[model samples]
Target: MTVYWFMMAWVILFGILAQVSARKVCVGEYLGEEVYESRVHLFVAVVTFAVIVFFAGARSYVADTTAYIKMFNDYPLFQNAHDVIFDSSAREPGFRLFSILIKTYISDNYTVWLSIIAVISGICVMVPLYKYSCNFGVSAFLFMASCQFTWMFNGMRQFLVAAIIFSCTGLILKNKTLLYIIIVCILSTIHKSAFILIPMYFVAQGEPWNKRTLLFIGCIVLAMLFTSKFTNLLTDVVEQTDYATSVEEFRNTDDGTSIIRILVESIPIILAFIYRNRIKGKLTPIVKLSINMSLIASGLYVISKIASSGILLGRLPIYFSMYNLILLPWLLRNIFDKKEKDLVYYIMIICYFFFFYYQMEIAWGGLEYASKILNVKY
Candidate 1:
């Protein structure tokens, strides 16, 4: 506990230092691109690694880490990889195999493996953010500081996959058709819910909030809500199979986080909708893709929780995080003239951070409890 407090102070002190240095490089008149990029990347890498190590290491004391911790020691794969994956009926076969490989090959250190996963997710987010920032000469560091980037670091495996798939969506420069197919195929392996995003490529190309778009969103929500018989069908496939029921148990244990994220994370996205036309011209194809994904993800989140026992819609908000991190920077860049509105930008960011803090506390029980135990007084 003392170490936790010390670590928290250390992180704040160093974080401020990094932020100051980054701002100097980013907001300067003589902006040397190379210097700015390196400084920002180093700061992000350092802070990302520190946060993961701190929370994940103290997770038993600070967060409800039992679910993730279980994956580390469970070598269900090396012993029965094929039976665990193919003969089984769960949609998470890709994750199952990946977990097995981690258990088999990675150092027995659970924290190390989780850190690696976190780093991968963080880097995935950086790719889209970088591309979007490059498209319009905005500050990448400010973009990184968005709630989406930080919120995702705390989400376990589901967000990791979301980050990867969402980033891939943003990076579709040329050969978009091939990129779309490949990313969707990859994401489906992690969570079948990702399959829902495939058609969004076409949907994103259309105008926002159109009659057809709203109707389609309404239909998917209705389907998720009224389609429990289909979900039950999914469950039957599980019962008939011989894979461990353990994964099912893990998937079903919701802890009430997803529901909270759906309501909370959508606030910014809702704001985006209100300012749609203003941002429409400013937003690039990838940025537009992200916004569309966030909207569909928001709709999915409404009824997705019905199957939390087997699947969850709560994670859909992460699609918002992926899109909005870059989108917010673009929006802010457009709304406020850069030279004079830096303070306003900071204020907006501060308010958004408050939103993120409360959202994560309500959504993730581990974080909720940690805030309480640390007596941080909110």
Candidate 2:
């Protein structure tokens, strides 16, 4: 707990420091308005990246990290690496193949593997924040404070795949749908859940509060109203996809998503809807896509809570949730007038920090960190 708490504090403090030293993100103005164009302070961002990647890579256990460590060790040595990677029954060959190459060429130790993976995942996530976020510092804070950083610590396969897909934020904003879909197709081999993002490419397009946005809301409402029916349909789809028996495993274990998390995810989209008309006229393509993705993430979280299977539906939102880190900071900067902006900023900081503590100390209270290299465990 202390390690995580310290890591979170260090990242947020540096992130805010980076915000203090801004650079010109664009020449004149953003969104056709003469607003703060200077952003993405590089020095502090690199610092934040280092601290985060270090802790993530050094971890001995955090939700599925120990499992991944075992998996990495059990992977056969380089002699049969090709067969293992190319095996027809391989669920996600890309990651397996990647692990083999690292083991074959680099050190075979899992520490080396975890460190390398941590670096890759960190870069994938941070690059997008550097490019799209209005307040890179705030977005960095949001990433940790919102507990999205857990993706780096656990769920390595899916989150790593998601991080790679997130790095292609440019394609989504540039309307390079075909190329983006192609990328998703390739990454789906790393984690099949990535295949879900294929249809989301279309869903993420267009203006905020569009008919598609309404449709997402409608889908959530229907899923909530007819949870049993939705579960059966979802289960059939899962079966056909041929993933493990996650459906049955979690079918009756519906503790549901935390209401606190749902509110945290919901706030940004709610704010967007309130300021929809004001923001619509000024939104950059990236911001628009961020809002749309935020909408999807929030909706999924809500449905996960209302529906019968929290784990099943909850897993789906990671595809879109990173965009909330982008969306939230942008909303804070642009949506309010000058006087309200400061208040909103403080309120955001307080709420997010509280949520961070709640998640780490209570919800995920058993989270422990151990590392031989660091010579510390807590």
Error of 2 at 211 (Å): 2.2
Report the Cα lDDT for residue 354, model 2: 89
Write model 2 residue lDDT over 1-378, tens digit each, in one string: 778788788987788788778776552354556655547666667888888799888887777787898889989877887778888876878888889888889988888898898888889999888877888888888888888888788777788888888899988877888898888988888888788898777888898878888888889889888988886777777665525556667777766788888898888889999988777767877888888999998888887777654566677788898998888888877788989999999988898888988888888875777877788888
> Best TM-score goes to which candidate?
2
CA lDDT of each prediction against the hidden true structure: 0.53, 0.82
Against the true structure, candidate 1 has what lDDT? 0.53
After superposition, which runs of candidate 1 have C-alpha atoms over 4 Å from their true positions? 1-50, 53-64, 76-82, 134-155, 170-175, 206-264, 302-311, 337-347, 360-378
Clashes of each: 1, 0
Name the top lDDT candidate.
2
